[model samples]
Target: MSIAKTLAALVVVAALAGAGITAPPTATAAEASPPRAQAGEEVFYHVFFRSFRDSDGDRIGDLRGLTERLDYLEDLGITSILLTPLQPSPFYHNYFPTDFETIEPKYGTLDDYFAFVRGAHARGLKVYLDQEIQYVGEGHPWWTRSQGFAGAPFADFLLWRDAARTEAEPFLDRATWPHYDGRQIGIAMIDLNNPRVRDYFTRVLLFWADPHGDGSGRDGVDGYRIDHMMDDLDHKGVATDLFAGFWRPVFEALRARRPDFRILAEQADWGFGEDWLVRGDADLVFAFPLRGALIDLDKDKIVQAVRETEAITQADKGQIVFLENHDTDRFMSLIDDDPARARAAAALSLLLRGEPLLYYGQELGMRGITREDGMSDSNHIPLREAMRWSAELDAPGAAIWYRGDKPWWTEPANRAHDGVSVEEQQGDADSLLAWYRTLLALRQARPELRGGDQRLPCGDASEVLCVLRESGDARSLLLVNLGDAEARPALDATIADDRWIDLIDGGTVDPSTLSLAPMTVRILGTP
Candidate 1:
């Protein structure tokens, strides 16, 4: 009846269930029993193609560089690599595609791309290509057709906004809101109403998803990270219909072939809630609402934001956690440079519902703001400030920040003297990086922390924000002191009875009452 007793019962039942489910072999197991993606556990890696250096000192980052980093990625427990577009785009970011079939030569040959995929698969890492279908580069061959692009039902595929109504319609105005890459000569809006265009788009997607070249030439792609999906205009008032139509066949087809294939849609806003599931295509959506609050100065404010996110998004917290991604300003800079607060945010991110994305430098206390250089410039590459790798910079259960060539955007703040490098932080047991890694590991080790029907463990949810995640009998509790000063909050440890173990501090917690340090976060569960 009590929370502890309920949790103990659940654990026993789970053990019985798992006992019947034969355990997979260890790392030394044969190839046939190779590791697989853990359910409810997914990791995404954001790779910038142009920001890498080849062995020859070439300025471009190619598939080979990524291939080489597979172990590094695997070490971090990343399950998938979300590559920025590899298509032949005129710019370095690869978002503006000139050729869908070709890998950017600057990033190496198509063969290199193939090798990267093969390498990733070898490491059991699924690869997801960034799909930016809303727009194409100004120089795409389709735009060059002189017949005004009349290809059967695809004639209206490329949209041509009414020149007269351009003043009233904001999305149609091209000259004013140019693309991020300067080379964009004009706007790249396509006519989603055209079925032919839709079919063509589907064909392209299917082509990539087919590993046998049965549809196009390439084999199946494991997953697709749809880009700027929210940017397209839905003249028919059924935006979900259009995007879903474009994807339903592809997703169904891929699942029919590779059942484990994933689709992570970029639903930056909250509109795609039901459609994401109805379409049965996307496995994940960017939790932007959560990102907007994670950086707020007030911990209470952040917790309140989390509660709202749980309510508004209608997504199972276990499936839709927040992330500070490549598109946004770094979390550190956005949070006013408070390292402790940053750790608190990190704790919430790793412990809360949904999956968490560790943007490259995020582990190293990196900081930077949104700038005109574009998202890639602001948070991805330019923020790659030098990371400390000295023995002193290590963190328990954490990997070194920069195991390879320094990224192009190395920060001056992370220089040797500041003692912020991975090496320096590694030495300080309470370093932000260490705190993040420890809390993350703790969250992963406990099933209750993964999110389920949540219960506020503390008597007062607002002041001390105590949350309990439970599935059947498995339970994990997260407690944060939202108040500025030390506050001891009382809680029903058992929901029915008061007893808990403060996992973070390694102390037995009597559910009836507990004192939380200012902005403190603790994970509690039976070992």
Candidate 2:
């Protein structure tokens, strides 16, 4: 069936169900209907465009390459994608933008970006563009015009330490870095206190949210991932307390223009990020504490993290949960490449009470860590290496941007014949990729796992972490063995009364007699 027809049929089915005319006859009075769509139900895949796939074979991943991979993402069951910064930048990561309005020349043109968005939307997937508007490189017109020009139009655009505008306000240590053009250029923090700067970004955000200004948003991005979001502006004491003054206004403006637009914030401190969601008017915040807890594999720490997350996140807002991202070391490396631990981590990530984020290549057990060489921009290359598509690691679509003479490619995580590529894992039932697909499918089929409230049970068992998910009349229990040995944790009497259908293996089992293998997860739903 065509996508349009499928969508239309779904709408009709939803309308009939709302009218109380459609439901299975066997559904009991205690059975819960499908849960409504919520922000936390979305599963997002984070993609670094420069490392995902390359279409033109310039060794760099681009918009066209990403567009071609929409089928893969959709089949993997992710509802959204969070792309790294796409604006023209002086850095390979594209975080330090020189131009915010246009696409990077290496990626593609604006038309290509629009086409990609359209293709993603047609597949019922959301596209979230990453925005790092707080800092501008020396190549930015605002920075170039403000330098040494007393009456320049953009003189107040950047924050300077002196009236002469010779020294830019320090971002970390140095205010200047070598641009892609091989010349040292100044990097200046934007004066968020200035109303003009706030209004400029508001316009930029709105443009991306509705590119043609038709309010249809068909060709535009669905949301934005704000990078390094901060209220104190790196604690420099320059742009202080921007939540109420700067960000709230911009977010309000964007929402006024596009009510359904989403803003996912990355807190600079990597804390709970409650302030970003409550005060900054953000819809989603990163669950950095939960991520750390999950990687440590401590049951108490994991329970505590879940409690803290539940306490802070509102019903309308959500947290983005993940095991690893572009900035963090791979989960496989963190766990010493243990396949069982990796599978358990995947279960926790998808089953947690938040919007799960899957980093590209994470499902394939790809491993990488930070390489601290002296060369600028080379340190992060290892973590952002190419995606492994074939057993030989030289497939046509593989993005080998960091190859040749670089230490990153020499000792790369994606080795040939390593059984970590899509080609190797496609038909392997026990592969990490297959495990991810199963978890994703289960999460989709069970509404309780998606929009349910999480309660940590089995607290007495220190080696096992248990989470009871409840939404309306639906309930499910997730038992995870965090220990290295087998764990036979007893469930609460109230929860153990009902027989459970093992969602993983499709077998009936009693919850009271649950036994978990080492580093494994079992999801049980009330039968």
Q: Name the candidate that leads on TM-score.
A: 2
Worst 10 residues of 2 by lDDT: 21-30
How do the residues 1-527 of candidate 2 rate in per-residue lDDT, one tens digit apiece? 21122223232223223222211111122122222234667999999889998999898999999999889998888889999998887788898888776678888865577678767777778889999888887688887877887578988988888899866775666866653234665668989999888877776676677643445554567789999999889888899889999989988877776777889999888999999998888999999999999999888888889888878988788899999889999999888889988988899999978899999999999989877654355666777878887887667878887777556767887688989898999999989999999999989988888888778878665577888888887888888888878787667788888778988788888866767788878889975
Residue-wise C-alpha lDDT for candidate 1, range 1-527, written one tens digit per residue = 21122223232222223222111111222233235455466656665545432423443556676677677666555566777787876554677576665567656654566667666766777677989776566666555451243453422445544432221111333432333333434335555556666655654565456433333212245778777554235342423455555566656765665566667777645542445544445767776666666656355555566666556444431344554665666677766677667767777777777666676657666665554454222234334332233333222222222334433323333334455555567557777766766766666567666545666555444466666788777777777776778786556534526346767777786644657677776667754
Point to the candidate with the largest lDDT.
Answer: 2
TM-score of each: 0.76, 0.90
Off by over 4 Å in 2: 1-38, 178-185
Candidate no. 1 TM-score: 0.76
- Stretch of 10 with least lDDT, candidate 1: 18-27
Residue-pair clash count for candidate 1: 21
Question: Per-residue error at 280 for model 1, in Å?
Answer: 8.1
Model 2 clash number? 0
